[model samples]
Target: MRITEVEIHEFDYEVARTGTVGGNWVYDPDSTLEPPGFVLTIRTADGTEGHYRGFAFTPPMIAQVTMVAEEHLLGRDPLERRGIWQDCWRALRHTDHFGLGAIDVALWDLAGRHYGESVSGLLGGYRDTLPTYASTMFVDDSGGLDGPDAFADYAETCLDRGYDGFKFHGHPDVRPDVDIAICEALAERVGDEMALMIDSSSLYRTYADALRVGRALDDLEFFWYEDPMHDGGVSERTTKQLATTLDTPMLGLEHVRTGPYGTVDSLAGESTDLVRASAHMDGGITGALKTADAAEAFGTDVELLLGGPAHMHLMSALRNSSFFEHGLLNPESTWILNQGFEGEPESIDDDGRMAVPDGAGLGVEIDWAFVERRRTGHTLID
Candidate 1:
């Protein structure tokens, strides 16, 4: 069946609090706060529709999705995902590929619905459940996760909750000594029972600083050290040096622009011990899978970067990847994104594992009533 219509819905959902590190958004210091959400709906001639929700949506991104859907997607078979993705990629070559990713995932959702199987099954399911780690939000002045002792206490809480792993997103202004203290505290607290990791988020200003932190992690036998320095995770030379200097394996390339090619190049350069792939950032599931295959070929593991159904599907299919990241978590507030989904698959169970929904498509049930209540604007392509 051919796609007959495409609808873009924009809405706002309140977040409990804003997370800041060094006077900026913790994720991207330069970027503005993102709009709540953008939901894309692709309709077929037979009345079946595919839906996908995107994070950090902006006006330009919504416009790009609209243009791509109207220009290259409408009237094409939804099942021709690869062709559509390629065409959209070429059309938007001068722009960010997030729009292409949004449409591509929607198409996959449609295909899953058509086949009456979950997206993971469509991608060749390997397992129904995945071990998950609680990825914490950046440190704040608030008493919640402010210091090393606080962080250790939080790790104990997570361990009690059945998490097998805990990853800390430290404050941006934190120094090497403080970083080392946090690492040591965590290792002393729960390191034996749980796999511990640290994501500097590229806050360290020098190789020496990163090396210091890396050496501490090595002493503690941490799982991985990520985005260690201010090079923003792009410099193959710096990453290679850091990997060589430290015993802890480096996980890099989360911010790299090119999809599978970038991952393969970093692997070939021996810059990273483990690679990172996000369905949202890596050109959707297609790009993520390509990177995964590349990592598999090199005998390296590709860690899925974020939590979501799409991410869950990719992690479930790939054997090399280890744990699902339940991220930006905070003690003061919940991590709920929207009230639209009937089931929240991202929530970790008592075993610290997340299960993939077995229903058709992404297996997510959207609450249209909630969407309509929250919607601020809409666009339709026919």
Candidate 2:
């Protein structure tokens, strides 16, 4: 069936138990925020529709989505994802392809529904449950991810709760010393028990700082060091030097949003040990799979970055992926973007593996009531 119409439903959601500190989402236990949320939906003439809400949404992205959907999506074949992706890429050539993923994801969800299959199944999935890492929030002074002991204590709790891997997001603004302390603590506390990693979030303003933290991670035998420098993860030269010098594997390119094409430049430079892709930023599942194929051809692993229900499906179909990135999670709350889903966004079993949603399409139900109840505004293309 042909695609008939596209829509963006915007709503307002409260961010509970989360707030920013030091330019990072910190443990503000009493924090509550009302932020606008957007969901992209694509419909076919057959009354089949697919929905998406998992990406890191912003106003500029919403603008781009509007442009791409209006310019390329209406009246196209929903199943002709590759063509749409390419055309949208050309459309967003001036931007970072920000809106392509949301559109493509909705289209994939639509296709999966039309065919009576899950997105993972649509992607030729082999695994049903994927292992996960407890990706922590940036170091906060608010006692949530505050210090070495606090971090170590949290690691112990996460391990007890069945996470087999842990990733640290140190000071949003970068404090190498503090970060080193916490990484070392987690290593000593439970590194032998679970894989450990650190994502500096491109906050290390100086090469020396990134080097220092990388060295500490090496000593701890950590699993990976992610986006260590303030280069927005695009500089091949800087990353090549760090990857060569560090014993710890480097994971980079999350901030680089050129879809699968960016993976080629980074891989060719041998700039990172692990590549990063997301259905959110990488032109949706189509782009992410292209990235995974590119990384596989180069004999490297592609780690799916950030939160989404779409991620489980993507990861399940991936053989070269490491772990399902569960959270920038704290003790008190889960993902704010999971508001209108059937269950929470990421469902972890007792074995620390995330379950692929078992139904058709993206395999998750949307709480349309919630969307309609808190409706803010919408854009529709017919």
Model 1: per-residue Cα lDDT over 1-382, one tens digit each? 9999999888765445555566433433233342467688999999888887876534656777877777798889999998887898778777767677678778888899999988999999888889988898776666667779988998999999888899988676857777788889999999899999999888898888898899889999999999887877888999999998889999998777677888888999999999998777667888788889999999999998877788888787898998999876777655544345775667877787988778898888777777788898998889
Q: What's the CA error at residue 174 for candidate 2, in Å?
A: 2.0
Candidate 2 ranges with C-alpha deviation above 4 Å: none
lDDT of 2 by residue, 1-382 (tens): 7777887888878767778865567777778766777788888888889998843655766899878776698778888999999999898999888888888899889888888999888888999888888988778777577889988998999899899899888887567999999998999999899999988889999899999899988888999999988988888889899999989999989888877787898888788888999888778888999999999999999999876878889888888998999887877655564787766747678887888887889888888888898888888888
Whole-structure CA lDDT of model 2: 0.85
The C-alpha stretches of model 1 lying farther than 4 A from their native spots are 22-35, 57-60
Q: In candidate 2, residue 312 scores what lDDT?
A: 89
Which pairs of residues collide in model 1? Answer: none
Instruction: Please tell me which predicted candidate would have the highest TM-score against the true structure.
Output: 2
TM-score of 2: 0.97
Instruction: Sum up the clashes in candidate 2.
Output: 1
lDDT of each: 0.82, 0.85
For each candidate in turn, the TM-score is 0.94, 0.97
